[model samples]
Each structure stands twice: as C-alpha cells, then as structure tokens.
Target: MPAPNAAAVPVTADHGSATWRLIKAESKLCLRDKVAPLWGVGFPLIVLIILGAIPTLREPVEGGGGLTYFDFYVPVLILFNLAILATAALPITLAGYRESGVLRRLRTTPIGPARVLTAQLVASFAIALVAMILFLAVAGLGFGVDLPRNPFGFAVAWLLAAAALLSIGLLITALAPGRGPASAIGTVLFFPLMFFAGLWVPIPQMPPVLQTISYYTPLGAGMRAFQDAYQGNFPSILPLVILTAYAAGCSLIAVRWFRWE
Candidate 1:
C-alpha cells in the first residue's frame, strides 16, 4: 500500500529464510556483474603481479620503518580492493536498482527495500573479503610478502574499514539522483581517497602537512591501522576512533536520505 520508505516487517524465523534468499540472489548478481570483478579484484591482482615482478620495488622504503615498497603495497592494494567495491560496486548497483524502480516495487513484497539493502551490503562484504584473502595469498606466496604480523588486529581493522567504506557508498547512493550520478560520484571519490591511503606515495614519505591530513581521512586512518597490524602491533586508538566515527556518521546520514525512487 505504501512505498520504499515504509517500515519493514518485523523479523522472525520465517522472515530470516527470505533474508537468506535475498542475500544469495544478490551474491549471484555481484558475481555476474562484470564491472565490480574487473576493477575490484582483477585490476588489483594484476597490479600486484606487475609490482611483484619489479626487482626494485623490493628495496626497503625510504621511511617505511623497515618495510620495502612491495611490502607496503600489499596492504595498500588491499585497501584498493575495498575502495572499489564500496565506492563503485555497491553504489552503482543500488542506484541502478532505484533508477529502474526495482527498489520501489519491493515495497509491496514481503521482503522490503531495507532487506534488499541488507542483501547488497552482505554481498559486497563477501566479495571484499574474498578479494582480501586472495590478495594476501598472492602477495605472500607469489611475491614473498609477509602476512600481517598481528592477524587478529588486521582483521578487526579490515572489517571496520569495510563498514566505513560501505557506509560511504550508501551515502553516495542517497545523494546521487540516478545511476549516472552515482558512478560519477564514486569515481570522483575513489582517487583522492586512494591517494590519502598512500596509493601513489607512501604515508611515511608524504610531507608532514599531508600526512597530518591523511590521519583524519577514512582510508588513511584505515591504512594506519593496517600498518600497525603489518608491524605486529594492534592498531592505535586514534585511528580506530576516527574510523568508527566515519562509519557511524555516514550510515546515519545515508539512512536518513536514502530513497527508493
């Protein structure tokens, strides 16, 4: 009777069965969609290969504590994977669903638009997790990069980073009018975010001013936490706090503004 913004049916044992189906369907769609796989997984994996083959990148970074360039890149590329999935893959698909009135139509169904949103988030998280493990495997076995020294800390940081990035994607979807604008917004956000994550220049090598700015950025803080894990320590409190703030703030804004049509 109402629209996409309507309150969802309360969850129950049977309702959760529908939830599983939606997530499974979305996972299939995520795989079939060429854009996400190509950029999120394929491109990063390809770059890892090329970077690994370069002998010079194995040299110790100028100010990267004790890490080599290649070692530094392993985590950065992992960040690349998450960024692509969150900014490009997640927002584009959801905006397309809205533009095509798929979300609007869901209001009349037992599984409402909110459930579809949950499914999309689950699917994106699954893909990003796979890509993360794959990248770690390739970098460790193929390139001889060391695994994260603090494995548990690394995982915590990664999951928090994913939550924050996914929330940003949702915010983009909320603000963009259509699929075109969503893609445009995602692309616009991608490069600069990666830059602050130390894609082009290692954070240790950045000028003091830029490094200061990077500390506050979402990916930058995530990278800082990742580096801590890489170095065999738990992430410091400041970066964790910053990441949590971003995740909470962006999710609140996205939930408020998101429209089904």
Candidate 2:
C-alpha cells in the first residue's frame, strides 16, 4: 500500500454534483446512526404526545393569550427537536468523525473537510425538517394544535433558530478535545437552553429579571419568535437580531479555530 499525498487532491470540481453526492452519503451515515433519529425525532414526539394528553394542558388558558398549553407546546417541541439535533447529535457525530480519523483520512482525498462539514450540516437540517413535520402532523391530529398562523414568519424564525443552534454545535465540535468532551459540553448547554425556551416555566410566568435574560438566549429568542408567529404577528426585531448574532458570532469563532486533526 502507498501513502496518499495531502496536496494531491484537487479542489476544483463540478461543485453542484459533488456536493449533492456528499449530502447523499452523509444522509446515509445519519440514518445509520440510530441515536440521531431516536433523540431528534422519536423522543420529542413521545414527549409532546405525553404532554398533550394532560387534561389541563389541552384546555385553553386566559394567560396564554387565548391558546391552550398544547398550542404553546407546538412551537416548543418544534424548537426542541432542532435543538436536540444541533446540540446533541451533530457535534457528537462531527467530533467522533475526527476522533475516528475519518476527517483526517478525507484530507488526503479529493473530498475535503469543508465539503464534509457542509454535507453533514445540510443532512442534519433535512433530518430536523422531517422531525418538525412529524411533530406538526402528530400534534395537529392527536392534540388539535393549530399550525402557525403566520407561515412565512414562522419559516423565517425557524431558519434563524436552526442557524444559531447549528453554529453553536460547530463551535462545540471545533473546541472539544474529543467526542466525549463534545457531548458533555453540548449536554451542559442543552438544559439551560431548554429552560430558557420555557420547557420548565413559560416565559410569561418567569420573574421579570429571568424573562429579560431569557430573551437573550438563543432558544429563548427563538421561542419568542416562534410564539409571535404562531399568534399571527411578525417576530420582533430584537429576537431576530439575537438569533443572527449567535449564528454569526459562533460560526465565525468556530471557523477561525477549527482544526482538521
């Protein structure tokens, strides 16, 4: 066997075709990872269903702006699925790839780390979209939760939220020493994000100071945008700016510090 030359791999190519192939390959790899689907799709759906079954949760509440708890939960679960995929599944997979020398091996081939990273990101986005659809379908049919009243606004907020969370995942993967460390760091961030997203306490019910701070967390800003869209209002500029800041700031730092090995 002969050793491969790092610089021998050509960078130029029909990027469209190459990127599509890379996405397809990453999709297959994602499917093979049982944990991704379990946490990203199944667990969230299961939680939503269980929560929706609560009698009190199914009833409309006055303080909830005339919507049921289930309605509020619809967006919560939507963001929750993406958050799990971004924080828990993505960083672990990318870090593990590096740990297993897959990324290093690709460096000597025509396929480079940038392509693989983009492919993984695209594939993860696709999976999260599927999970979102599943949650909407199940929630609508099983719990009578209404779809977002402002579809376009909902979509914009959703994209911003996804970008912010995915950027954080990349930053974690870039910084962690190994896959285990990456997973631990992601898990540590997840609980706080979820809390601010109103998993344990609705934003309206939180103390004034906590509510102020929650608006600044990525998931908090996301949850606000999602809820606003659900109420047929445009997501406010503040949440949009917050989401953009997290996405751009984390992505910049991640790319600047990223290491192939």
List where candidate 1 sits over 4 angstroms from the true fold. 1-15, 62-66, 110-113
**What is the TM-score of each predicted model, taking all chains together?**
0.89, 0.90
Candidate 2 clash pair list: none
**Residue lDDT tens for model 2, 1-261:** 555786787575655567688899888988998777888888998999899889999888886677887888888888888889888898888888888887777778776555666787788888788888888889888877888899899889999998898888878877776789989999999998999999889999999999999999999999999988988998999999999999899877886787667
> What C-alpha lDDT do the candidate models reach, one value each?
0.86, 0.85
Q: How far in Å is the alpha carbon of 98 misplaced in model 2? A: 1.3
Over all chains combined, what TM-score does candidate 1 have? 0.89
Name the lDDT value of residue 3 in candidate 1. Answer: 78
Error of 1 at 243 (Å): 1.1
- lDDT per residue as tens, model 1, 1-261: 887766685556765688798999888888888767777788888988899889899898776677788998889889888898888888888898888988778767887545666787788888788789999999989878899999999999999899888888878877676889999999999999999999998888899999999999999999999999988999999999998999889888886776878
CA lDDT of 207 in candidate 1? 99
How far out, in Å, is residue 2 in model 2?
Answer: 26
